[model samples]
Target: MTMSEPLDPNVARAAKLDTATLSDALDKLGIAGQCYRIKPRDVNFRMTGRAWTLLYGPAGKPCGTVGDYIDDVPPGSIVVLDNGGRDNATVWGDILTEIAHRRGIAGTLIDGVCRDTALCRQLGYPIFSKDHWMRTGKDRVQVEATGVPVNIGDARVAPGDIVRGDADGVLVIPKEHESAVLDTAEAIEVAEEAIRNAVRGGMRLDEARKQFKYHQLQTRQEG
Candidate 1:
């Protein structure tokens, strides 16, 4: 699909697929989309949307503001922050969480930390990050760039990439491969479900898996 094409339909389809399935799909495609070391604040919280990336770096002679870009983020867009995986300082807080939730933003994913867990939990705003700390990133770090490629938990995220997060953590799907990944994930889900059904119908677990070729579901396919 072209860059100008609407991604909402693919994003919607991806929203139904869990991180596990997506991860498997990525593996089958030999893609590194899994964001390791990043996890949701609350296990029950889940979110999916196109990424709006922000990169953070050490502050220069002058410091920069934190979370001033929230207002610019469109509804249903996921705010992805690349904070260099710094757990000592936080780039997100109660104010940002409150605004994002009120604005109907999908969620926030950070490579570093976020503060104000209480507000995010109360608002049911999903945040996947390395961890949470009370220290502010105001003077420690500054916004280096926005809408540029950034690394989050070892995963490279680009503007408009499909981001999915859940209790299992977060995964980034490259926009160019979104369609293929979603199609593969859906097919895997269907096969697994069939295996489950077969087992429930008195088939042995091993037999059901063999019948469904479960072992080959996630095996990398040669182009």
Candidate 2:
């Protein structure tokens, strides 16, 4: 079977939680999932789904296409492009954005950069990346591989990994530990909510935090 599995219910469950909560859960589980430096192109953009990874490298004698593999991405899957953090060239742009939006792809996450910000913003297509640039990747980069493991920011993302992004940033959840991560995140969310409610009810902030053991919420737990 391919590394990418059928969409998991955990994807749905993850959508309900923000990246901060999920990041904390990953910390508690000792999983390095926070995709540092990867930010949403638009503050309002958000997405959660399985990763469909692509790896890119310096262009060869005969440069390959930048986005041909996008057509194969399944609906509801996020396109993860690893461009080695090159900010000089863009691997994604208007055409790819239009196609992905129309195809029902969840979103695009790039380790490097993208272009055509206006189109992406206009279509409400979610894209998280290091940044956006006008220079094209056409002759600067080539598709090195697809459906393989890739690195986004500093986090490793394998095909089928759960990716969640929002205004805060992106976080990758390893498929093998998705359940544990989600469970921990939900508990953290509940505890945080309770603390908030207690504070709203006139309880001292310190007392609420002490009551919920909030300081230890994201502490690594050893088995």
Candidate 3:
């Protein structure tokens, strides 16, 4: 990568905003992007990248491997693993964490759980999941497909969708809605900042909010 190549505009824009602001933007547009229950391994962790989705399911008589797909994920992409929110098995672990950190991968978001929490934290690699456990998914769950649409919490994340995560949690912005969502999120951020500035300058909280239209920022609009 050189000056000849430009950063992805959506990715760049999403990086400036947190998941909370983005969530509000999603609501204002009536788009479902908030992922419920999923949380970051560390509150300080943050990541923004396009999603490279993997769907997992209960293994058959002969189980499949859990990590081969990590090699195929492009650098700067978020690996989204959907295991049907199964806590009994772990689809991610130490090996994958080390490899992803070395490969320049943005991070990993699992709809289920991950293992090797110490390794991930030590490596400073971002991982957002329902929980972490030592159990492995090796003989329990198998990859149903790669580069496919998957569910993360209550949100639907398609391959190539913008996946951003922070201390609050993770959220997916569909590729088709990325532009609008980013625009709306930026506006909401601006309005909120204005409200804060007003308060700092001596305006009442309610007055500042009203002046900036803060209350209506996340309200859905009519078509």
Residue by residue across 145-169, what tens digits does model 2's lDDT show? 9999999999999999999999999
Q: How do these models rank on lDDT, best leading?
A: 2, 1, 3
lDDT: which candidate is best? 2
- In candidate 3, what residue range of length 10 has the lowest lDDT sum? 1-10
After superposing candidate 1 on the true structure, give the runs of residues whose Cα lies further than 4 Å from its correct spot: 1-7
**TM-score per candidate, chains pooled:** 0.95, 0.96, 0.96
Residue 211, candidate 2: alpha-carbon lDDT:
100
Q: Write the per-residue lDDT of candidate 3 for residues 66-107, one digit (tens) a residue.
A: 658777888889999999999999988888999999988889
Q: If candidate 2 were superposed on the true structure by all CA atoms, what would the RMSD be?
A: 3.3
How does candidate 2 score on lDDT? Answer: 0.93
TM-score of 2: 0.96
Candidate order (TM-score): 3, 2, 1
lDDT (CA) per prediction:
0.91, 0.93, 0.90
Residue-by-residue lDDT tens digits, candidate 1, 1-223: 4322234789879888999999999999988999998999999999988999999999887677664899999888899999999999999999999889888888999999999999999989999999999999988999988999999988999999999999999999999999899999999999999999999899999999999999998999899
